[model samples]
Target: MKSKYKSIIYSIGVLLLTVGVLDKLWWLYICTIYTEFEECRVAYLSLFPERFQNAFLLTVIEILLLAVAAIIFSESKKAIYQKKASKILMIISLILFGWSVFSLM
Candidate 1:
């Protein structure tokens, strides 16, 4: 893929990662803090079934896609501060993976 396209994909992947993290936080808050709501413990969490709401699987996919994006971004001549960006992405990926695992148990 062209550098521009690769950059765009990376950007979109970051946006998605943000959305996923926020969604998980919202889910946590809903189930924990809002325990008074019966639906929060029952239907809402499993409304779409495991295939759709499975955190561990989704986090794995995100991390893999982010790695691809980071590789493409670093290899591009137009890349700026590639090292810093790569480190930041790596840190975020690790944190996300840890959170995903913790959520599973």
Candidate 2:
């Protein structure tokens, strides 16, 4: 496939993956708005272990996808463009992963 097409496909994939993970966590935070602080804290703590496991799995998948994307992009004619796009994807993925880890504490 052409680099242009590959880049677009990869970009959409990354965006969708990021949004899917964020949406899950966002709903959890949204739920806290209606609950008592103590209750919320208890619920969050109880769910932390399970949520962390899922988040870790998602993070690993994101890393693997990003690595594959990077490799594909590197072989493209537009090296600079690919580099920038990959960097942006990496940064976004890292931030999401960091947030997931922070929430565990």
- Residue 19 accuracy (lDDT) in model 2: 62
Write candidate 1's Cα lDDT for 1-105 as tens digits. Answer: 465576576676567557656756777777775556666754445645666675456556655654554454444324553556756665665567566656557
lDDT of 2 by residue, 1-105 (tens): 555576686666566546646655755795767577666545544554665645446555555554454444444324555557666665655565555456556
Q: Give the TM-scores of the predictions, in the order they appear.
A: 0.53, 0.41
In terms of lDDT, the best-performing candidate is 1
Alpha-carbon RMSD, candidate 2: 6.0
Evaluate candidate 1 by giving its C-alpha RMSD to the native, one decimal: 4.6
Candidate 2: segments with Cα more than 4 A from true spot: 1-5, 28-32, 37-81
Write out the backbone clash pairs for model 1: none
TM-score of candidate 1 on Cα atoms, chains taken together:
0.53
